[model samples]
Target: MDGSSPAAAAVIERVLAFLDSKTVAACKTVNRTWYTLATIQSARNIDCHILQLSLRIAHYKRKGLLKSARSLTVDVSFVDGYLSPAAYERRVRDAAAMLQSSLMPVSHLKLHASSAHAALTDGEIHHGTTAIGLLTRALPSLASLDLSDCPAPLLTASRGECVASLGRLCRLKWLSLGSNDMSSATALRRMVRANVRTLVKLDGRGDVTDPTMQLLMDAPQLRQLDASGSGISDDCLLALVRKRGASLRELILSDCVRLTRHSIAQLTPKLLPQLASLDLYNVPVTTDAYQSLFNAQTHWPYLRDLKLKAAIHHASSRQESRATDDILESIGRNCPRLVSLRLFGCYGSTDSGLSAVLGNLGYLRELVVMHHPVDPLIDEEHSSSEAGGSQSGSSNTPTAAAPAANGPSSSLSSDADVWAGIPSLPSNGLPQHSSSARRAVLPLPSTAPSSPRPADAASGASSRQRIFTSGALRNGVRSQRFNLLNLDMTYDSECAAHLAKLSHLHTLCGRMITRHAKSLIEAQFPKCRMMVWNID
Candidate 1:
């Protein structure tokens, strides 16, 4: 009964396989059998790095655990001065040779680069030797490959050599070339065309163009396609969203600057009927279009994940417009089944906006929003993600996860199953750096930068009891609060009470929030932990 079934051993193996590192440690005290199961599961999701590359590989080989690695993250990324340039290259060469020869049948492989601030330093240094050739050449059996943190694109030894070798790869199920320069468009397209039959999820990181989307219509099983920040045209986008591609579920088109709300409104229920997660990061959508696209009763009744950024098109969008607020309200009323609602540039939103989302969407396990507008200093071009979990927030999505995409410095990343990571967003090839912004989250082992904490909001803490209300959550889903918030506005005691009611808050970025409110919330829910920006 201690495990998944009424008996200790029954179904325990499956249950043990899902525990994170922390949970795995706790399982050691349960019993020897459980300890063994937890240990194996932990080993399955180990990190293969460069600090002692050969030693690590030898250890894995000796134990015969190399072949059992389900989700392997070979994060060899270090800073510029971490080691001498010669030493760095030598270690990388040695690691690559070993990994190539070892041939660990790891289904999922995540490759990292030298440092998060690779943008400011050398151009293609590969500080940690996160070379594409190293990864693809070594893990030939990779079914899922993620390179969101690499210094450059998948050009390992030579210009087009490693990418050309992608043709030899076993049909990939999941591939994320996060923000890496995919200028080798022809080669990248060829690889996709070849693997069209097996490629299920692709995180292009916005480096792709219209042709890639065109090539995917024939992809019978392509469920998730993230073209965030790509130059995909409206016509091509519409063409791909048809009955033929109805199997498509998650579609991300953030910062497709060419898109208009009118074209977006055309996406009725008839197009990609199985749509669940839609992320339009920086895409310009009109107020009316927002309502129509998210028409739960009329359109996507099964929609779960919805990400809409505030306007990036200043000329077309009206400043001080209440469009975003209205849109959030509509979402709460319509998409009640939503699991994750992430809004990045929603500077126009106020208390009412977040309140509506919190009130409805009772089943929401992850709510990521920029509760306050970004100051001029806050970087928006870079992409930052956590190195903690998998791709999706939930466990059913992917075995391993990354941090949330906080623009390459204010990082965090995942969900229940979607190989939890930061929206599976491709980086701009350069890892992000942190700023002196304040962010708070459930305690965890993290490295996000922090600023000065703010003073308590004591003067405004009136003793009179206040009813901070947010219409009842959709379900009596009490154990159901999972949100990641980064706010800069000052809150009174009443605001804190309202937030406290949101029981399932997962992570929060209180960059300029008062200390009292943060302390109150952390005391109630102490689970999720990421980025460490400071308060006012």
Candidate 2:
């Protein structure tokens, strides 16, 4: 349909709304009317640093595209292409000049360092400050600014012009300076106090201490605060929450290790009534903290997304495992509106405990359950002892109980607990098992050699070498799917069959799905995509 006609234009608008940016860009070439509409929409969000930003801006300006641009991302990391620090600074200055010359009424500007860029050194930090000053001076209407992962120090700008530009940014309601070295709270306090009344979202995930937090005491309009890894304790956190609690909607305190049970227990629903998303990953909390935060009496009805993944391979593994159990149970009792739950290193949690929480949160769309490290992997001496112990008990290890590969029953678990339902093959083409005792000989990694270095021997006999499995995938979301059924490390034929029964499932990611299990999964769910990686 051509965009010239009113009815056809309305239909095309609706269709364009549903399509992604690339599709919309492609649709622009269909006709003149479409071209005009697409150009306007495309210029709304511009990635100025994706290619030669100066050339792109010049081309867009020639085509009258720069005027429509509203949200611009000025990535300064590309300056790394230059060999010397002088070359990098010159390029940054040139970029700033080009941006200054452009007339793109950009309201949202994100000056970020690319992920590949290393942490900013003192020299680079100075250059970064100059670049920020240049860009902010050019964009007078800037309302939202994200300097996240930028190498600049938190408190002081390298140049006075940079600090003056920040103070002049009165329209900035959203400011994100995550990962900056804010060693001087004095400098941060001055800048924040200038725009404290209008700032809504403040992300200070840097070297923020109690002094840094105290700067936020007057920011009553703040709605979202991410002070992750800021090295702040309960006293500072509680103080910030007390001042900004009524308006704060999202709080991310990930990796704040100094926060103990005494401080965490005080995080009642009353403190953050409007809180919607809470992330406490790697924050060590005791059982009492979990109980107090998510008890029957405590309730955060608006809370939807919660991530409490523990920092595995730590000294407090046992305590953290127990804390996980208590937290999961409390989630079942309190957080009824929970949409996503991630529990890493929850080794002590049983199938029953997980099932209980799942049953309660029916609207849950994402569940990440990475159980604690296997018993053998965590302790070197224990692994060595187990290796020796297994050799001694090789005769007693149930080798005979392992079913024959040729037998049809061998492919299917005899136990009912292995599968949820069905006596034989279900419509989904999966066999249901009733028992948990189904046995299989796992292909474990070989043990380390007896002779090892002194360091290796002291750490553990097994520390000399790491066990390499045939297949294992690195952690992270590998792909996007319409229906995400289950993502876990429990890879086996029985678990594959059980997962196959999930009728709505479209994607399954695991460390290792054996060839047999992969084939079974394919047979049961023809449309389902399986991503398996070998374990290390």
State each model's CA lDDT, in order. Answer: 0.58, 0.61
C-alpha lDDT of candidate 2 relative to the true structure: 0.61
- What number of clashing residue pairs does each candidate have, in the order they appear? 59, 14
Superposed model 1: Cα runs more than 4 Å off: 1-31, 49-57, 75-104, 115-139, 153-161, 182-187, 243-245, 295-297, 315-329, 342-360, 365-536
- Cα lDDT tens digits, model 1, 321-384, are 2235567777777776788777664534544656676666667776655532221121122112
Best by TM-score: 2
Model 2: per-residue lDDT, tens digit, 311-430? Answer: 433333344435444566678768877776766545445444565565566566666554422222233464466468555554454333222223342233222111112212212432
User: Residue 129 lDDT in model 2?
Assistant: 66
Q: How many clashes in candidate 1?
A: 59
* Leading candidate by lDDT: 2
